[model samples]
Target: MVVYLPSLTLFCDSLWTKKMCGAVVLFVFMCLTATTHADHHQPCHSPNMTGLMNVMSLKGDKIAQGTFAYDSMGKKLRFRSNESYPTNTSLGLDLLMLFEEGIFYEIDSKNQSCEKKKLQMLLHPLDIPDDSRFYTTMTAGSASIEGEGLKINIWTGSIPHMKGHYSMSVTMGCLPVSTFYFTETTTLLFSNMEVELEIKDPHLLVVPPFCHGEPVEDTPEGTVNSFLNEFM
Candidate 1:
């Protein structure tokens, strides 16, 4: 079964104005309060072998979009676009090859397949930070992932434009069994604005579908608008 999570978009002519900054500050306070309250309850359970599988798709203010598929067994496949803005012609054309674990596949954008030599590199795992407590922060953006199950969060601002934060949790059941809890916050200033995305699914050591042709460029504007509306 497919579950569609709500998507959000924020449009501001200028995030640097004093009024916008105040609104952002209030939003952050609310998020912190909500998170604090939720933490007091039972911790969220990670996905397991018997849990449901899910696919999560995310689009960020026309800057980036991607999709991830996850099974109960900590395995996942992710595809991310390279374009700064989503394009009707280039939608789903760019891909970032990622494995269930932290391993990255050598992507062949032309053929849309993994290169043999690149797959060989999978003999070893990629070097990723294992610290689960480290939380990256952001504002006015959104992210999603599925490992053992699906986890996603959306924030309200932009990098170098606005300030906000995002949170996520996912479980993977590969070999050792792992779960991830992640959080990130960001503050944008005139000089620089940096947003960090964190994924913290934990399991010991795990070892880890395709629609044909390009996405239709002339997809009706009404359909596209409808899809965007569902998120709003």
Candidate 2:
């Protein structure tokens, strides 16, 4: 089911000063302390799943918005976007990352050309992670209205390997709703998620025939974000 995250856009106004906005964001985080009796547990690590969702990433003044599908069990992710930002355009417009093979394919749909590159890093699944601290429990929408909302647990922590501070909202049933990730400069938000517990098609994870025989390019240095370290 599609989960709409309203919180991410609450402070997106350009009229506010950056320093003031930062303080407001910090205050919101400080207020979400976990209950004393609650267990600080991470979301379930589901090995098999594939679904599509909207993605928005902000790095400095640049913003990238798109939709992506992923197969956790197959260890693959594909992202597509209409207009691209410099932060993401470094790889390619349409990209596919295959973690198991340590490679990625940049597809040029118009020309049906695919460029391959070596993926230097391992895949980081969307799990909340063991180091994450439980923040609090809250509802996304009105529980009184049927089929409108679900209970979610909030979490925050730094991923030492990735060097980013992150906060995520996960359903009580272990599904992810939204995620916010930040480093010294960049900020990423993954919202409007719809995750399935099973793979929809095996071919979704397969490298297309057009990508075969393409010379692999060396991967450049990159930083970790919500998904891949450099290629998210």
Candidate 3:
């Protein structure tokens, strides 16, 4: 005699439900463990870290209008400026500022033909919190300097995610006589986006008096004059 199992369908359905629940529980546990691991290895919140980001952004007018990313372990910094709208001009300039053991290197872009003399001098990284001081200067056909401005202090507890603020002034000049001030604040994001920079008080800058002329290489002055005359 053959016996029929009438409750087989119900038993199979129960087994499928149990397996699905077990898989969901396993996924949840994995996610929790990953989050805990990340929390354990996360960088400690520091006032100096936030300040560094702010100082980098405050350096110049062009610096304010770009996206900045930094790697803490690698000590690598990258910034890219969005091209200005309506003009469709490329404003992207890449700087690989490697900060290794209190030293740095500023790499120039391909389009720009930079001689070694035009490079900026390396300065000590600014120590945040108690002492916020950093010094560096760049000289090309023109010169500009980045340093810690007055009234920089670490502000804490404004945001849970942010560590602190580093305030500083940025100055640029063609000649030492022509200079402008830009106030900035750096916030430590403490996540994939490590830093956030906000320009607190930005002042409209005026270019200093400087010479501008194309070199008359192999072309005579009169030949250039005739070309100008044709345009006129």
Candidate 4:
């Protein structure tokens, strides 16, 4: 899904909330001395985990809340959007991307159907890109006491060959808190995230039995552009 905002482009892939390969631009007005730097936070990878994710398109005024699983070791990603506005856009959409097998499955539990397509891109690990520059460190929540807040690190960079820029925020522990993808006209925000170091339910990474033996077709459409239509 792509949501257009002034001077921003937010693109999200079905496999991972559609911001998979989008660019990132972070505009901060704090101290230059604090904003411009590189450090141990350069490229921190997230461990295999499952968590809740809230995806929002600023200009489009669309929102989808779902659970997502990231298994870096297995090179698999699964997301099931159980709630969404305008119901037909993403609600009840379950997607599984198997990078090792070079395939993806779109399972429709209501109809007991599945669409198997060849996965087109290489694995995009959940981590701060090596090229990312340290933007700044800030506190996440408002608190009366100076020390009573969550410390977060902001990183900024652009995806090579991709239009626009990207920004991501992670806790001091390197857990992803939110990510922003910006392009010429869209702004995509992935926020209200709760990530754990454990998969919680291993079954989420399993291919649904209904999708077994399903013929794999060439990618009918790019996963990044078909997010909104998946629910239809």
Top TM-score prediction, candidate number: 4
For model 3, the superposed segments whose C-alpha errors exceed 4 Å read 1-63, 83-92, 101-130, 133-232
Pairs that collide, model 3: none
Q: Return the candidate ranking by TM-score, descending.
A: 4, 2, 1, 3
Please say which candidate is ahead in lDDT: 1 or 4: 4
Q: Distance from true position, residue 4, model 2, in Å?
A: 6.5
Q: For model 4, how does the per-residue alpha-carbon lDDT over 99-147 read when each residue is reduced to its tens digit?
A: 6787778888889889987644442325566678887887644334676
Off by over 4 Å in 2: 1-37, 40-43, 47-52, 57-62, 83-92, 123-125, 130-133, 141-149, 160-162, 194-198, 220-232
Cα shift from native, residue 126, model 2 (Å): 3.5
Clashes of 3: 0
Model 1 Cα lDDT, one tens digit per residue, 5-107: 2222221223544355435534633553122122322222223221111112221222323332223334433333443434453234222222343333334
The candidate, 1 or 2, that scores higher on lDDT is 2
TM-score of 1: 0.32
Error of 2 at 199 (Å): 3.9
Greater TM-score among 3 and 4 belongs to 4
lDDT of each: 0.25, 0.58, 0.24, 0.60
Model 2 TM-score (2 dp): 0.66
| Per-residue alpha-carbon lDDT of candidate 3 for residues 1-232, written as tens digits (9 for 90 to 100) | 2111111112222444433533442342243211111121111212212111211111111122233444444443443344221112323343434444222222234433321111122211221222333322222221123431211112111111122332221212110111111113331111012223322212101111121131223433333211001111
On lDDT, who's better, 2 or 3?
Answer: 2
Q: Could you tell me the lDDT of residue 188 within candidate 2? A: 64
lDDT of 2 by residue, 71-93 (tens): 76666777765533234433335
